[model samples]
Target: MTTPAWENVSDAFMRNDKPYGGGAFRIRDSEVMTLKVTGPDTPFKPASEWKNPEIAEHTEPWMNNSGERLSRSTASFIRGTLDSGMTRYFQQQAQDGAWWYSKDWAAQYISTGWMDFTRQEPVNGLAPQITRLWRSIDGGRTWTQLKWPEDRNISYLKFLDPQRGYAIGWGPNVWRTADGGQTWQAIALPPMATDYRKPRKQFDAVDLGPDGLLRVAYYVGMLGEVRLSSVVYRLPWDKAQFEPDVVLPDQVVVRLGSTEEPPGHTYSIYALSRLGPQQTDGDQNDNGKRTGAISMWPGHRNPAVRQLQTFDERYSLTDMDVGKRGVLLVYAGDSSRRGAPHQITLYSQDYGKSWKDIDDGMTQGGWFDSLTNTQYALYAYTLRKRQF
Candidate 1:
């Protein structure tokens, strides 16, 4: 059905209930557009409960720049309860950076979406970007911004489960949670070999292995350039520290996030080997693409740190993770030298041994619900809950 002419679509997503249970989405006019699963006709419901709540002052960028610099631009966040049949906005601009909000599908009583608000504080004329993690439990009705340590430089955030997650980074890496992110505690990382020359013990990725060990991958580099050795730490899920579980060397680790269906039950990562350069043959062909081989770690049955083929394509990877039966869902941008603008979603049931092009020219973001085999893709201003 065409979008209502009276108001514009504020955001779109599936109801997250049983697949094909046509539901509603928010529009700009404080109304809900109730969509039918099988029909084109949808009715609108007035959402009068949604109102702008009181918030802190503005100083950050509605576009860019830090707070102390104090530019004229402003910023805010979208907050409102989804089940309440409405939408509302929150006022929040701080000393620096940017905020980007996106929508996701809802299945149970709670729906969720993640937004990263970056606070770029310039030091000696250099602005180092600090992205603060946030999650909305009530379907984007409200967002809880997680605390990020200033001392920790690089972090890879993952949710093993909604309430249990981990944030691993360089500056004394690892902040964990067992309460669905309500509170996060710092977890000490296991010590590494002493490299006085400022060796980069930068944590690259973390995943729960099928062997019941938590595998943590980090780059052992000299001043940030990777050396020829590979190391993946391991620890029991119940344990809070690490011990070496080193894996194969020479490949760069490009970590993908977890699945949306189970939230964090399935974790995946890509070990990329630099092929140096490439010239693609597609319309969104790439030039000088850095990837040659793409190996994925899938399933709870595979040996820990074991890499499997997910895709042979040299396209630029945007995101990837495992779904039901270890099926791989891959999102890619143009294979171009710079990549992106042209996006595609691919799925493979038997790892990457086989594949399906779900959307070749997929624009905007998509959250794949494996349980329903539905792709909740946000296009333009409308949410298209279409099936693959």
Candidate 2:
């Protein structure tokens, strides 16, 4: 807890020789001392002590998440533009410049596929060339860097076995390696409907499940009144084998993930669907949960997807990630039940089959999220992995 500021008591000094005893003097313990000296602005502005990005410096500052022009460079998709707020974690980012900060400055960029290969939280980043590649032989306890294929803007990659691996990105294309990480062969996908003007694809990413099912997520931008949704595609690793299947008939696919059922778990691949534009938070209702409903496809090649969850338009799907037997989701709102600004982290313990919030303790026990950030004291429940 922050100690309050010291109070001046000329009378206490005059009352007795003991400033803190007979005079009844003590520290005020005011939190004002720790509070930021912020200027009165609707959208919070940098303090006088901070370097105002509006005023250029010798160094070309990064485009702050906030509308300001200076400060550290950040992705375009975060919520609040500063020390604490960021875009949803785990959601696939298709655009090159799109990125998010879950709990730090480490921005995770996306490739062209349905998700990041290392959906692991707090991983360094998916930024191209950050490391050639990260491989974990001991079931992820420790990882070793290997030479990633030099030129592909790979968004998703997973090894089916010791020697065979597949990656998709750089467009609606993919790369495959038969001899582990030594080399990659470019595989071009058949031409997609990119010839139109309305609802052109802005972001694209791919996802592959443990069942060898391939899925692609597309955020098609609305160019005219002719809005389109059925953007997700069931791709063919070998086009000669099968044809691509359009998953959602009318809604846009914003998030895609797959988690194998662990023992008694009913988990499988899932997708979050949005009925409207999927670009920014503005697309969501006032409550933060996006307008789209979350749908799930149960195990063993379940072609039928059932509605898993939906909000009353008050909330939107801000961020998400899949787990071994659970799923992690984050939702933000213009205001909370008490009508204060808030964000909620949702988790599904039994994979995408179910969701509920338990005392994750990270946000439950209110803590300073940053040097100037304080987490919300709300969210009676939040979904998160009980174990790592």
Q: What clash count goes with each model?
A: 10, 20
Angstrom error of the Cα, residue 226, model 2: value is: 12
Worst 10 residues of 1 by lDDT: 106-115
Q: Judged by lDDT against the true structure, how good is candidate 2? A: 0.40
Global lDDT of each model? 0.45, 0.40
Residue 212 of candidate 2: its Cα lDDT?
53
- Highest lDDT: which candidate? 1
TM-score of 2: 0.47
Q: How many steric overlaps does candidate 1 have?
A: 10
Q: Write the per-residue lDDT of candidate 1 for residues 1-388, one digit (tens) a residue.
A: 1111122233533333222222223333233333222211122223442233343333322422333233322223333333453233332322322222223422111211212333544454434333445565554455666665443443445444456656555443666677765677766665552334343345555665433455665455432243544455666668877765544456545553333333346545445433332222473654445543446554344336545543544566666655555566667665533443666566666646766554345454445555444445555545555433
Q: What tens digits encode model 2's per-residue C-alpha lDDT throughout 1-388?
A: 1221222222211121111111101111111000011111223334443477565433223222232321121211212222222222222122232111112222222222122323343444443322134443432223344565444455456545555656654544556667655677765543343434322223344566554556666644442333455555554445432233445545667667676543555546667676555445465553334465677666444357677776445554544556542433434342224544455545554544555532222232122121222222312222111221
Candidate 1, position 29, lDDT: 25
